[model samples]
Target: MFCFQCEQTAMCSGCTGHAGVCGKTADTAKLQDELTGALIGLARSVDGNANRPTASTDEAMLAGLFTTITNVNFNNQTVQDMIDRILAEKRKLVPDCTTCGSPCSRNDDYDMNKVWNADADIRSLKSLILFGLRGMSAYAYHAMVLGYSDREVNDFFYRALFAVGYDYEMKDLLPLVLETGEANLKCMALLDKANTETYGTPVPTTVPLTVEKGPFIVITGHDLHDLKLLLEQTKGKGIHIYTHGEMLPAHAYPELKKYPHLKGNFGTAWQNQQKEFANIPAPILFTTNCLMPPKASYQDRVFTTEVVSFPNVQHIGEDKDFTPVIEKALELGGYKEDQPFTGINGGHEVTTGFGHGTVLSVADKVVAAVKAGQISHFFLVGGCDGAKPGRNYYTDFVKQTPKDSIILTLACGKYRFNDLDLGTVAGLPRIMDMGQCNDAYSAIQVAVALAQAFGCGVNELPLSFVLSWYEQKAVCILLTLLHLGIKNILLGPSLPAFISPNVLNYLVEHYKIAPISTPEADLKKLLAK
Candidate 1:
């Protein structure tokens, strides 16, 4: 088994031989590859038959790609079931393929190893396209949950999947790589609209880390729809609901916050879950990605929904019945007293929300602050977090930023310093938690609004993005930034192994994308510029 779709691949290269660094065993890795291969075949069949993609086709495409995302699904049986569903869908698309005596390979399953072993440059470009689609699938899936679906976004998945299966030249694959970014931008926008419209625009809200004494449920991942369902189901049942990981931002939404039992945030970020959830008496419900394999102590208490599946963990089906999760929480009974928890920085509480609506509504004050020199710059330091020790760079970077500069962060990476007392710049909170990675859309909006108010291009604003990436979602978000022609972005915790020298050079020459260095040196460089 070989997989290199994430930033934490073995030895900074591909994961091969046995288990992956994420605890995905050889068998499970192979199954995920098989699932991906079958999805490609289904895409090819749908493309070959020129059949309009139905909801099932679109959903299968989303679920299949989402399942292969790092740390999402670690269950071999569930992955095999997804492959079976894809094969069934493909059979419907091309009924004659199986019986064809001299069948062409156009619609056959792709061997992922072929791409992994392809020319370095071609593989780099194809990897960009494939991984970008996987990242975009998460956003698309969220939108679909809110009864929003874009035909252009759905069709691009099949087109991109077909390209991944074929031996496309750099010239052939390069356009689709950028197209993936362009498509993902729209996909994210769709999700943003869906979320804001469904849950109301997020507002700045401070959340405590203290778990009140009672039976409680901790819901992780980026699925707000699932959280709402769980919150509704657990209401009147005396079960407290605490948001965890990306769900930390869910507390900022007015619709979700209204629940009396919807209490405070629990753990720090996804990377810390293993340690944080180890002896926790509360049952945790994972609605999306960033699910590390559960430890033995807490394995039975973890519940999965949507595409998140562990081998033996209980799963909530499409009916969205969360009775199993609620029951587990009841049995555990939580802490004997109101347990106080603090963030990594030892702050008793952390604040979130401050999304585009919140920030942009205060745009006038922000503009005035800049004009008066109360705020000198804006730094958007955000992305996925990982277990790599080097990720401490983000914590240090945020710590070292000048007080005159405001820091806006999103995704799990913010957990590194979200609890830090950055203090306020002008009248605005110095560190703004802009929801999850998908809320990069909100950050983009705020940046554009700032630039427009200042009558300058986005790059011309006093803004810099110091991003840390771990998985495909980061890949797609980075691509979207490039698609918008944003320049001088710094990415790190190490560059992707898939980005061949040529591709990296292209990025450097055109967009000035650079791997991060020391926080002191990077801050000096950005400030001096």
Candidate 2:
């Protein structure tokens, strides 16, 4: 097995031989590759068939891609099941392909090994397109959950998938990479609209880190629909709910927060789950990725839903019945007393929900502060968190940013310093936690709004992007930035292993994207720019 679709690939290269760094075994990784290959075959079938994409085909596309995302599904059985579904869908579209005497291999499954062994430049470009689609799938799936779907986003999946299966050269594949970004931008916007319209626009809300005594459930991942379901099921049952990881933003939604028993957040980000979940006295539900293989001590306390699955874990089905998780929490009965958990910085609580709507509403005040010299700059520092050694760079960087600058952040990476009180600038907290990973849409909105208010392009404004990426979601978000022609991004704790030297050089020369250095040095260099 060989895979390098995540930031923490083995030794900064592809994971090979056995288990991946994410604890994905050789068998499971290969199964995911098979799943992706089948999906591409389905795309090809739909691309040439008389039938157009149906709801089931679109859903299978989303689910198949989403299953391959790092940390989302570690169960080989489920991976094979998804592959079977994709093949069945392909057969549905092109029934004659299997028995055709003059068969063209166009409808046959793609050999992923061809991609893994392709020329370096071609391989890098194709990797970008494939990974970007996987990332976009998460956002698209979330939107579909709320009954929202974009035809453009759905159609682009087939185009991109077909390109991956075909022998596209570097030059031809390059535009598809950016096109994936453009498509993902639309996908994210659809999800943003779905979320805000369904749950109401998120408002500024402070959440405590303390877990009140009682039976409680901890829901992690970026699925608000799942969170709402769990919250509703556990309602009036003496079982409180605590948002964990990306679920932290759910607290800001009026529909979710309306539950009286919906309590505070628990622990830090996903990377810290093994240590944090070890002794937590309640069951944890995983709605999506960032799920670590459960430890023996807490194995029975873990539950999974949607595409996130682990061997032997309790799974909530499409019916959204969370009874198994609710029962586990009841049996555990939580802590004997209220546990006052603090964040990494020892702060008792952190805040989130400063999304695009919240920030843009105060656009005039932000512009006035900039004009009055009360604000120096704006920094968007956000992405997924990992257990990599250099991750603390984000915490240190956020710590050392000038007080006059506002630090806008999203995703689990913000857990590194969200608890730190960066104080207020222009009457707003210096650190604004904008929703989840998809909420990068909100950050983009705020940036465009700021640029408009300041009478300059986004790059010319007093703003800089200091991003840290861990998985495909971050990959798609970065592509969206490049698609928008935003420049001078400082990305780290390390660059992707999938990016070949030529592709890296292309990004460096064309977009001024650079690896992050020391916080002080980067701050000095960015300030100078």
Candidate 3:
């Protein structure tokens, strides 16, 4: 098996051999590839039959793509189940093809290894499209959970999937790659609307890292609806809920936070889960990606739902019945006394949910601060976090930002500095957490609003993006930024292995994309500009 779709791929190249660096075995990796290929066949069959795609088809495509993302699903049986479902969908589209004497491979499953061995330039373009779609599907899935779906976004799944299977030129694939970005932006906007409308717009909320004693449930991943459901079911049962990883933003929403049992976050970014969760006396549920392989120490305490599956783990299925997870939490009975936790920086608490609404509501004050020289620059320091060594660059970068500059951050990367008491500029927290990685939409919204208020383009605003990427979601977000013509972005711990020299050069020339240097050097360069 071969995989290279994440920042922490083996040695910054592809992961091959018996198991991936992320703990995905060769069998699981191969099955994920087969599942992806089958989904592409399903896409081709849907287009070939000239039938309007069914809702189930769209969902299957979304789940299949999302499942293949790094660290999401590690169960081969579960992945095989998804592949079987896609194959059935393909068969339904071409019922007679199974027994046809003259069979054409037009709608057959693709062998992904072929593309992996293709020319680096062509492979890079296709990789961009495929990986971008995988990331976009996560945002779309979350929106669908809240009963929101965009038809155009749904259709583009098939259009992009078919392109991946068919032989396409550089010209053809590049537009599709950008189209993936355009579609992802729409999906993210839909999710933002779904979250705000369903749960009310997020506000500035400070959450402690302390876990109160007794039975508690820790949940990670990007699903607010599931967190709400769990919060509702666990109410009055003495089971407190602590958000972890991407779920940290749930505290800011009015409807979700009203539950007194909904306590603060539990851990730093997803990578540290194995160590952080080893001895915890609470059951943890995963509702989305960033699920590393559970160690034996806490494997029995882990529950999965909404397409996140691992072998022998308790899975909360579509019924959304979290009874088993709740029971596990109660049985653990948490700590005997109040247990204190802190972020990577050792601060006792952190703040989150400074989304577009909260930031924009205070826009006039921010403008005044800028005019008065209380704020000299803005740095968007966020993205997916990984186990790579160089990631400390983010911690240092945020630490070294001038005291007067505001740091806008989102996703798991914020875990690096979220607990650091950076104080505030003009009554605003110096480092603002803007929900999940998908909340890149909120950051974009705030940037766009700042530009409009300042009467200039977004680039002219005193803002710089210092991003760290791990998986496909970061790929799509970066593409969206490029689509909006945002420039001078800094990305690290490393650039993607799939990006050919030519494609990298194109990005450098057109978008001014640069891998990160030292925090002090990059800070100086950004500030001087």
Instruction: Tell me the whole-model lDDT of each prediction, alpha carbons only.
Output: 0.91, 0.93, 0.91
Candidate 1: regions farther than 4 A off: none
Clashing pairs in 2: none
Give candidate 2 misplaced runs (Cα > 4 Å).
Answer: none
lDDT for each residue of candidate 1 in 97-168, tens digit (9 for 90 to 100): 899999888889988888888999999998998899999999999899899999988988998999999878
- After best superposition, candidate 1 residue 81: deviation in angstroms? 0.5
| Residues forming the 10-long window of minimal summed lDDT in candidate 1 | 45-54
Across 377-438, the per-residue lDDT of candidate 3 in tens digits comes to 99999999988999999999999999999999999998888888878887778989998999
Sort the predicted structures by lDDT, highest score first. 2, 1, 3
Q: Which predicted model would earn the best lDDT?
A: 2
Q: 306 in model 3: Cα distance from truth in Å? A: 1.5
User: For model 2, how does the per-residue alpha-carbon lDDT over 381-487 read when each residue is reduced to its tens digit?
Assistant: 98989999998999999999998999999999999999998789989899999989999999999999888887889999889999999999999999999999999
Regions of model 3 farther than 4 Å from truth: none
Candidate 1 global lDDT: 0.91
Residue-pair clashes per candidate:
0, 0, 0
Q: Which candidate achieves the best TM-score against the true structure?
A: 2
Backbone clashes in model 3, listed as residue pairs: none
